[model samples]
Target: MKRGEAILVPLGAMIAGLLVFGLFCAALGLNPLAVYASIYKAGFGSWYSWQNTLVRASPLLLCGLCTAIPARAGMIVIGNEGAVVAGGLGAATVGLATLSLPPVLSLTIMALSAMVCGGIWIAFGAALQHYRGVSAVISGLLLNYLAVALMNQLIEGPLRDPSSFNSPASYPLTPDHRLAYFAGTHIHHGLIFGAVACVLAWFLIDRTTFGFAMKIAGGNVRAARLAGLPVGRLVVIAGFLGGACAGLAGMIEVAAVHGRANESLNAGYGYSGILVAFLARQNPLVIVLVSLLTGGLLASGGVLQREHDLPDATIAVLQGILFLFILLSDTLYGRLPFFRSRTPEPKPHAIAA
Candidate 1:
């Protein structure tokens, strides 16, 4: 089952998701294949479609880290969306406040500040877990609510743009300050950052001493502590790293996509990252792949809405079904015959003897 779980299961589940969608479409008297074709044309049929998918997936890739990386140490960090908002604000604030700085210098400061914001956000949950025995899940979710409220307050009050009598947002970043898209491509450097981060995370979690420590601690915290591993530090660092991913996502949104912090800054990339992490089974590289897949769906949502008269709710329903099925299947891995442990067979009855 583990072997099956590696790829085949996910593929099967995805097929199942499509079948479920077909069933739903039938009930609604719509053609499921037509809708799916629309999704394909809008999401992957052209360079433009692929670019949009990558653009959207870039944040999700980082946001996925916000959940998957920490999960290595048994932490359920879900406040990535908040970290994203805070990170974007941090980047924007630095960019706006330091107009005299070189672009590289300013961008560095902005990205670092955003990371700090995200790190601290998850650190709060870690602190609660270490000191108070509070559930990280609850604390993280509550932190999300607080973060959203804080974002609202900041955009509506302290950070409100004075010039544009339009949407509530912080002062926009200067065009010169925005990250440049590669020539002939809409995808920005955030996709590069997300890829780098995912690779780094794979190294940290699967190839290093820290990774070994997390494996030990995550397997048995008590035994790990007895073995002199700094379990607390591992957990805390994992949580912090998770938060940093979210924060970096925010920075990307502000510096590359939106050019400012605003209400839309918390547009649920964080939440979607959670879904991606679950789908990837918390594997960093797999998270990137899953993010791209989901990003394609997201990219198609607009076209699905406009061209086919499909409501946004249609996409939402698809996402819900996929997420629900993926998570539900997680418990079944390692238990099936295809994944069952293999033991050496006892020597055949000594026919030779």
Candidate 2:
């Protein structure tokens, strides 16, 4: 596809999605233009709102990498939700257990625990695919349900803090171990982690030899095998790396935002990250930008509900529409006439004869 069309087609779909969603708003006797403007204001108009957007985008950046990385290895795992929850639980467990340790050591242990737990949770799916011939997608999706149920069981029963009677939550981490906010903003250090992770991911995928092997494996498993590449190992490593990022996202949510593990950890950022990955065409660098855009849209949901008298799900519907259009437009990438290469017409120089 031509470079311009590669970019324009997606933009066109986004525009189409907005127009279609506008019609839906019109049916409800609301002005689409006003709604769009409100979304912009609530998400980015003020410095405070920008901080909120960045705060939300932090997890999204990590979670989106969960999908984008595995995709590079030709896997379709969507079990990041499970990884996030499990990671959060693991972090909480470790944090509470090591409360007497030095603050920095305790926090480091908690982060590592979260990443290992999350990585194991998702890697199980890859293991099943490689060993048992089960589908990765099925295993990953089913694992999400299992992870949430397990988290609820542990949180409400064994992990729950007795003092937190009003809410089912784990024991909060000590103040010293909790992540510090950046300057005067509500944003925390997790944003830095997420940005650094994306840059690392991009480098690993584009500049490293292992990443090239993964691409070859993803493109053709048979060819990869014939070339003596360890396809299974690559898939497993990719799955682990992806899940680790997601797990870290969960850990950040607890240490930075919630201070404890609870049902609130199931914030759907995992699912939303899938959209971000797809929207960014699975490029780790682009995922950062797309995640920020998605985060803005999510932050605007409350504004739409309050000021416009719309349901909280209004943004979800628009997102769903946008996702649908994006999928439909996927086929337009190289198929559009503008994207196709053309040959010059025959020269008329022979007429001189």
Candidate 3:
């Protein structure tokens, strides 16, 4: 495969995917054209709606990064959920522990706690991959379940708010401790943080030396090892960074949205993040655009359910279709002649250790 061929495969796949979506919508007694209109109107027709979509997309963009970064190193770390909850729990702890501290000091502590906890949460998986050569996909996935279990234990046990007789959740942050919205919108600080993280990820993967090494290792681990690059360190760091990004996303979800750690924090963003990463080819910048697109799907689901007499499950159907096409990305890449030409012929780059 060569460069030009690589480009065509994805392009062709996009066209085919749209057709599939259209067919699915039509068979369900819905007009694809009108459904699209409804989607546009519901999501972007009103400023409030658009803002809401952005808010939803904020965490998704970060979670997408959680998948995208590690992909470059050939590790499929699906444990973003663990990092997210861990980060959220860490942030809640920070806020509660520093209730009497100055506002700035408290905020800093909360942010650092989330980042550190998120990093450490996924670092365990990275260690396993590097030390034992365990499959990251499997290890990370199992760890996600573990994280969920841990969250349940913490919230129901030690972190439970005794004052909440009706709801079971971690202690809520005081009003002052919650992150405020941006100047003009209900969108919170997390959007800006997500945007910044995306930019940083793009730079790290596309412009930095580390990125290049990871790409090579991902393309062929044996080749990379032959070239004497530190494959173990690269793979582990990729997973750790990816997990940390997800953890920050969790922190943002708790601090800005929930204002307290709860089961609601497990909103499936971790799972959806996988979709975004795959659709974007696991490219950081592309993840941002894809997140917004999926966010619109979520934002519009309620509208369709209310006005079109469609079941709320329409969103699930659409999502299912999207994931179907997304997983076919590998097949699309090789099958399309134009994109097949884009894939590089075998390279002689030095093998990493």
Candidate 4:
């Protein structure tokens, strides 16, 4: 695909999605224009709204990486939810255990533990794909359910804090250990972490020899093997990097937003990230922009419900529609006349000759 098509196709699909959503809303007797205006105002019109969008985007950036990275290695791993859950569990376990240690050392340990746990979680799926010829997609989907079940068991049993009553949760981190916000804003340092991760990931995937190898492998595994590229190793490494990003996202939720690991850690950021990755065509830098847009859409959910008497799942429906449109638009690649290369016809002088 041409660079211009890369940008324009997704943008055009998004606009189509909005138009379809508007029709859906109009069918329900809601003014589509008012609904759109409300979404804009609630998501990006004010400083407060921007903060909310950024907060939501932070985790999405990392989660989107979970899918984006492995895609370069020709793996369709969708276990980001599993990786996030595992990371959260790892972070909470370490955080509770190191309560007596210095804040810096403890936080570092927690972060490392989260990354390791998450990497292992997703890497397992890649290992299955490489060794057993199992489908990464199936393994990843199953792993997501398994991770959620494991987390529920641990949080409700062994890791449950005695003080927690209504909701099951692990011990909370101390104020000093929790992630601090930007000077005067609700936005936490996790946003910076996410942004940095995206940049580093982009560099790794777009500007490195390793990335080129992965691209070659992804394009043709048989050719990659003939060329002596370690396709298995590349697959595992990509899975690990992707899962590590997701794990860090889980850690951020514990340290910055939730203050502990619980059901809240299972919020659909992982799934939403799959959408973000697809929308951005798995480009890390593009993922950042897509995350922000998705975050804005999510941030407006509450306002949509409150102002229009729409259900809480209204945003979800819109997301589903958008995803469908994006998938459909994929068929247009190389098929669109504007994006296709023009072939010059042979001159008539040949006939005269």
Give all candidates' CA lDDT scores. 0.86, 0.89, 0.81, 0.92
191 in model 2: Cα distance from truth in Å?
0.4
Better of 1 and 3 by TM-score: 1
The deviation in Å at residue 61 for candidate 4 is 0.4
Question: Candidate 2: misplaced stretches above 4 Å?
Answer: 344-353
What local lDDT score does residue 290 receive in model 1, on the 0 to 100 scale? 93
Looking at model 3, which ten-residue stretch has the lowest summed lDDT?
333-342
Off by over 4 Å in 4: 343-353
lDDT of candidate 4 over 140-208, digit per residue (tens): 989999999999899889989889999899878998888789998999999988999999999999999
TM of each candidate vs. truth: 0.93, 0.95, 0.88, 0.96
Model 1 misplacement above 4 A? 334-353
User: RMSD to the native, candidate 2?
Assistant: 3.1
Estimate candidate 1's alpha-carbon lDDT, on a 0 to 1 scale.
0.86
On residues 129-191, what C-alpha lDDT tens digit does candidate 3 reach at each position? 878877767887887888888888988899899886776788888888778898988999889
The lDDT of model 3 is 0.81
Tell me the TM-score of model 1. 0.93
lDDT per residue, candidate 2, 117-148, as tens digits? Answer: 88888788987887789999899999999989
Best by lDDT: 4
User: Higher-TM-score candidate among 1 and 2?
Assistant: 2
Error of 1 at 345 (Å): 7.0
* Model 4, CA-based lDDT: 0.92
Evaluate residue 34 in candidate 2 and report its C-alpha lDDT on the 0 to 100 scale.
Answer: 99
